[model samples]
Target: MLMNSNYKVAFFDVDGTLADNELPRELGIYGRIPESAKRALSKLKEAGIEPVIASGRNYEKIADFAELLGVDSVISSNGTYVTFQGEPVANHYLSTELVKEMVEQFQTKQTDFLLETPEEILEYAADELLPENILQFLCHCPKEDLPSLDTEKLIAEKVAPTALNIHYKHVSKASGVEEILQKMGISSDQALAFGDEENDFAMFEKVGFPIAMGNGNDELKAKASYVTDTVKNHGIWKACLELELFEEE
Candidate 1:
């Protein structure tokens, strides 16, 4: 059990924690939240904890999963965008000029990629103009074909075996969580988080209770306060029950 049991909010990573995330199918995309996950969220809500999504998915791509799980707040593009109770709170897009320059570099290197924004995804081509709200870039080409640009100013997170989600360096699920908690007058002590990827490590470090899934990254498990079953094995349900996030039957 956690040392603190006064959680007011819950942050969930989408790809593996709350849903079955298999991409190239959902690369920078969200599939669906399983019934077990939905039930967990419902129970968490009954316990008076607000559920929010903290994912690398873009704002438009992460919505259906949020709607399905009956959640309102979403931190998407790895924290480049944020919304609370279905209201927009923040949008931290990558620098347009930098993105364009990177795209040019990709072309010069003959890299094939899919560019994504808060609005849509497009294949990177010299003639095509990037969206004004560009949030991420998914390079389909060889990883080496991608530029070796400094990540101190931006980010390049591997989203799939063949793709990477690019965003600003400061954008991470933890950043959004910190902002949300500050605005809500809540402390990290009042937040519990669950996730299953390298990207989720930051969140695990920030929350009071960090729960890692059985199918999650071993590194993440090493850093977790608690570890649960895999999503397919009812990980969310098990953790909720164990953590007392749900009432006894």
Candidate 2:
């Protein structure tokens, strides 16, 4: 199962991929990054593969995680924002109409939600609106209660909600990956990506090697080039090892 050594970059999803989806005891904190994951990242760097965090989480929320992982590149807010080498690459925002509509819906339905701005996450209704398993940028409302925004309209405007239900326009993890690839002068086939949720579909589609965690969604696994063990079992390390992305010491 050895792969080509041409992989120049590796995009990693946060929850359920690099880290467990469980929340820490501290409020608004994400799960800890495993030591094995850290070692896997180090190996990638040693192999000349640039590691990047590609997550649906907002930039502010994922900043600490990126620092902890020692990664300078990030595709955050489901690709609405991206950075490379600690420099801003691109930033897309939700349309004004879309924002107004969402705010109205949230107010009407009394749904608890948080609005993610460039500066900070603004609490709309109350704290803890997001589930413990998920991050803070999402809302806890039911599908039926969600705003009936026209799908065709969104497509027409190039606006859409991510798999995590966060609304943004004209961007996805795929687009973010493309941005970084263009900037780094690397082709899509020269990249690898790891993911466990539907939000990662775009990233998988963009990368040459898409590895899904064992605990990942069924559809994602079906589409993956390889499926490894769960995060708790050091899936990233195992997959990289099996693919011979880096030599074992």
Candidate 3:
């Protein structure tokens, strides 16, 4: 499949899309992007394509990776927050009342939980019930950084008004993508999106072209306009080449 190189904006997911899903180890099917892929992204940058990172992580963590990619804007913690350059564009937090209710409900159900602040990710570990499989999949950060929190204390602490996340259900990557567009004064129709998981489904629905990684979920592949090769094979580079988005300077 081919994309319109005329797009003014581009949104990319970090895991399983741009970066290797098996981060920390960088050994997944689409491990770190290849040099060729990096060149292609650079070409897009040179063309004045406004690249945005849409992720379900906190702002600070996403910023670290964005700096490496030369990206200055990010949509983090789903659509709950957006940052342009180093300044915040928009930020949303779960209402204190909403948090109180959800926290009590989660305690009753014993569901593991996480709260994303602009600066940090806080996990509520009830006897370390976090499944190792999920942990392995999110190995981008150090184990020490995965701080355990006392839910009661978290509720007692006054949440700053500017915080961006208070997730109850799974984080919504779609919201992040939408936030980026809203901040950029563009529409999803003006962008190309790349994703690989269920969280990415909502985002794909709004874009003109949605590209899925070869190793992505079946549903995502079914909905995408194009499916690139596995991440490790320079899938992004290959797709850009095929789509004529990577012409040599």
Candidate 4:
């Protein structure tokens, strides 16, 4: 059981933590969020807790799941877009000049990449596909190719050997978390967090109850207050049950 009553909200990482990760080329199936997680959400609300999604995927990628789960706040693209009550609180974008420059680089290098606009992720073939509101870019290439892609405005973080999350500087899930907590009239120590990657570290450092999935990376798990089961095994629900957050009479 959790030892404190201050955990009023929960922040969840979309990939690996909530739903199976299926972006950056969609190499994996777009599986639905586990049913147990849905039930856990209901139970958490009953106990007076709020849930917000924090994911490397952009708003367009996580919206359907957020809608289905009835979540109001979402921190997307690691922190590029943040919303509360389904309204934008933060929308960070890369420089249009920088974005076009990346497109040119990828095309010149003959590598496949995806540009994340507000509405969807698209193959970066030309200027025609670039959206009026750009959010993130994902490049697919060998790890060795990453160094050359880094520029002053855009930086690369490896998601896989072949995929890197390229975004503007100083953006992180913790940045979005701070935005919502401030608007909600609370502090970082008042929330819980769940994640399974290094990208989740910033959020983990900020929240009160940081739970790492069993399948999470070693560094992330080491920092968590508690470690739950893998996402495929109802990780969110299992942690909820273990939390024992029954409302006080």
Which structure among the candidates has the greatest lDDT?
1
Candidate 1 ranges beyond 4 A from true positions: 1-5, 21-32, 124-129
TM-scores of all predicted structures: 0.87, 0.80, 0.71, 0.84
Candidate 3: tens digits of C-alpha lDDT, residues 1-249: 455667777778777778775556545323365666566667778876777788766577777767767788888766566777667877666555555454555566554555556666566554653321121011223323323333443222112232222343323556666666777787777788888877688889878888898989999999998898977677777776777765755
Give candidate 1's whole-model lDDT.
0.80
Q: Kindly list the per-residue Cα lDDT of model 1 for residues 100-139, writing each as its tens digit.
A: 7888787778777677776677776567666787777777
Model 4 per-residue lDDT tens digits across residues 52-141: 888777687688767777787888887889988788898888777777777777777777778787778877546475676778878777
lDDT of every predicted structure (CA atoms): 0.80, 0.77, 0.64, 0.79
Report clash pairs, candidate 3: 30-231, 30-232, 78-176, 79-175, 79-176
Worst 10 residues of 4 by lDDT: 22-31
Error of 4 at 86 (Å): 0.8
Error of 3 at 238 (Å): 1.5
Give one digit per residue, the lDDT tens place, for model 2 in 148-244.
6656433211223422355544567889999999989989899999999886887899989899999999999999999999987889999999999
Give the residue spans of candidate 4 off by over 4 A: 20-32, 124-130, 143-152, 247-249
Model 3 poorest 10 in a row by lDDT: 131-140
